[model samples]
Target: MRNGFKIISFFIDPGAIQPFVQNAGFQSGLLQTIVDDRWSETNRDVYAFWPRLSTLYNLNNNQPSTWWLRNGSFLRLKQVDLGYTLPNLKKVAIKSSRLYFSATNLFVISKFKMWDVEMGGNGLGYPVQSIYSLGLQVNL
Candidate 1:
């Protein structure tokens, strides 16, 4: 908060999951949702991890080379508000009035890919939202 302005922020870790579980289903399972580019596929070599079934025996291999520790940490501006009270507005038949502008979930900075790193499961969850608003207050 500063000069009649205030701001609040929030974020979640969305702890990491098995290398391929978030987006890729079990190797034997028929359902797979490739939600992020970091997930491994059949032949794609780019930032890809082993498919779900392939890592069944090696679930503990969470090395830097693997995308498991993809830094779920995120920073969000969250909300901000600025207001100013007009000098005695008695002349206008008003005692006091203040104008303000605000915003919520303004922006985010994160290394995790997909909708939101905090969503955890390769972007399968609903994404955070951003909102803007303006308002005025008066006291007679």
Candidate 2:
């Protein structure tokens, strides 16, 4: 079962043009409505598959509907941390030392490909950032 919600306004809604660059090959359900030789009388069930691109453009200007809703479920590798403690370093005048590494926003797995699903309907918003960090600690 699907959970969560995403309004795909930024991607599919022609009325809401995006300010940033968009992939030329980005395929949405709207693409399925582009009529071609593949369409025939038997495929009359296909609603609004217009023979002309202009007709499709006009249809897209309508208000949002259930067709624009998509499952927002996602799995994300939010963060990871690793650390190692060094043995006593009396010879070097240092009593102890340790090293550590950390990372955040590593990656995300989701069907909503337009942007981070957590961003929700705001596709124009900046996506979550990935961060990596390394550190050391010493005690004299």
Candidate 3:
């Protein structure tokens, strides 16, 4: 399992003076709901349990807590390779021939929706890349 250290920074941190431009984070939608329902009590059913944005902003002054912690465990299909070898061909003077296909970084299964668990902490580093390869080998 991966641990989240700076995950709260991705949301509304105490040092963040300017408004966030992107609203793609996990709490963005919930924050938006809080904003939209601030004036209407009827519209607060979705997040009635959550505190207002102002309250959360004030709470940000405190140190990070378990609230920001996330389960980053994941199951990934890291690599795969398949190959077939042909029988010896005396007529063609070929002792052995083989064909192979290989692939990497295929897929991941995880409850961590924010980012890849393998990336560690904030997951801001370069993303994992997918690669596919095919090859043929012949011995004559």
Candidate 4:
């Protein structure tokens, strides 16, 4: 965060991007999503790793390559937990008790690029959220 303004980056450059597809790389179970003849047009190759592969293109061959923006992010706080179980109170009419115990989304952690504040998967402008809980319980 810079001056309270979130810093984000994107890819927006289109140039000759050609990756030759192995003619013999055909698989039996899963088909490759991307393949090239090594002599295709020019554009920045986008590898979002999700949904599908994307690329920018010009309407005419004489025009320059088009570009788009892609962003990968870093880890953000997912959850926090702090709790305390009540002491032995079963001697009287009361039974088990608890205090100041809370739990949030403490399982999923974001695994994206270096500027992502999202959890789990990388989305757009997903600010990392923190869950704070307070409560009291008693069993009788």
Candidate 5:
């Protein structure tokens, strides 16, 4: 018999390197078209030029640029599980049992906004969700 009390066990899975396309941030291609009501043309500077809506609407003659690509790299916390095993319940006809709580897709720290970073195509997809669960396991 292993003469020791099983205290705590933890499992963590940090998922893969996900490269995605994000378009909701300030680095969007339609920056001038999506500004808020407080936006002003006078706010334009030498470095940040605000294009008129008509100018942007007539941009079929312009060439595409890579200036609107938001960095979509992040380390995601995929899942975390914490569990505790109870001592053997010999009299109850139960050998051992464990209770555990787990969570998935908990959080993401990214520069992108209003969208999930795992879609990876043109940034048009459903967002990811966080899930939580609790369970028990027994060995008889």
Candidate 6:
């Protein structure tokens, strides 16, 4: 694995006709290989497997979609949930009431991409942004 900023190669040739070493690979996840002063971008996800999940959402893949999930690149904000309801209902033969909040794909993991590749729509492939929910229960 390449450490620090300098290049770590297999000692074949640094300025030869073929810059790529024959059997050079990474050692572990702790080290990274930086090539040509450029880092590997989120390519795996942008080019992930587009399969048939359903008729509307992850169906044929080329169809119109509301969201797209990038694969094998980096960490991405993935769900969100928030809820609230009336209280003290369960005590009297009624459903209980409570309040809660949550978020999915809450924020983004990478700053390189402003928008997520997994997300797509007929529009311009906007992002999932944030989702919020509210609910209520009553005793009858």
Highest lDDT: which candidate? 1
lDDT of 1 by residue, 34-86 (tens): 32323355446555543333435555333344444444566766667767666
lDDT per residue as tens, model 2, 82-130 = 6677767899999877777777877776655545656544465566788
True-structure RMSD, every candidate: 6.7, 11.8, 12.9, 14.7, 5.9, 22.0
Better of 1 and 2 by TM-score: 2
Per-candidate clashes, comma-separated: 1, 0, 0, 5, 0, 11
Worst 10 residues of 6 by lDDT: 16-25
Each prediction's TM-score against the native?
0.57, 0.58, 0.60, 0.32, 0.63, 0.31
Off by over 4 Å in 4: 1-73, 103-116, 119-126
Range of the 10 consecutive residues with the lowest summed lDDT in candidate 2: 1-10
Q: What is the C-alpha lDDT of each candidate?
A: 0.54, 0.50, 0.52, 0.36, 0.54, 0.35
Backbone clash total for model 4 is 5
For model 1, the superposed segments whose C-alpha errors exceed 4 Å read 1-21, 24-67
Ranking by lDDT: 1, 5, 3, 2, 4, 6
Question: Comparing 1 and 3 by lDDT, which wins?
Answer: 1
The true-structure Cα RMSD of candidate 4 reads 14.7
TM-score, ranked from best to worst: 5, 3, 2, 1, 4, 6
Comparing 3 and 6 on lDDT, the stronger one: 3
Tens-place lDDT per residue, model 4, 71-116, is 3333323444444566678678787766653444433332322222
State in Å the error of residue 43, model 2: 12
Give the local distance difference test score of model 6. 0.35
Compose the digit string of candidate 5's lDDT tens values, residues 9-109: 33333344334322333344545434531224656543332233233444521334443344555656777776777777999999888777888877777
Residue 52, model 2: lDDT of 22
Candidate 3, position 82, lDDT: 67
Candidates 3 and 5 compared by TM-score, better number: 5
Pick by TM-score: 4 or 5, better one: 5
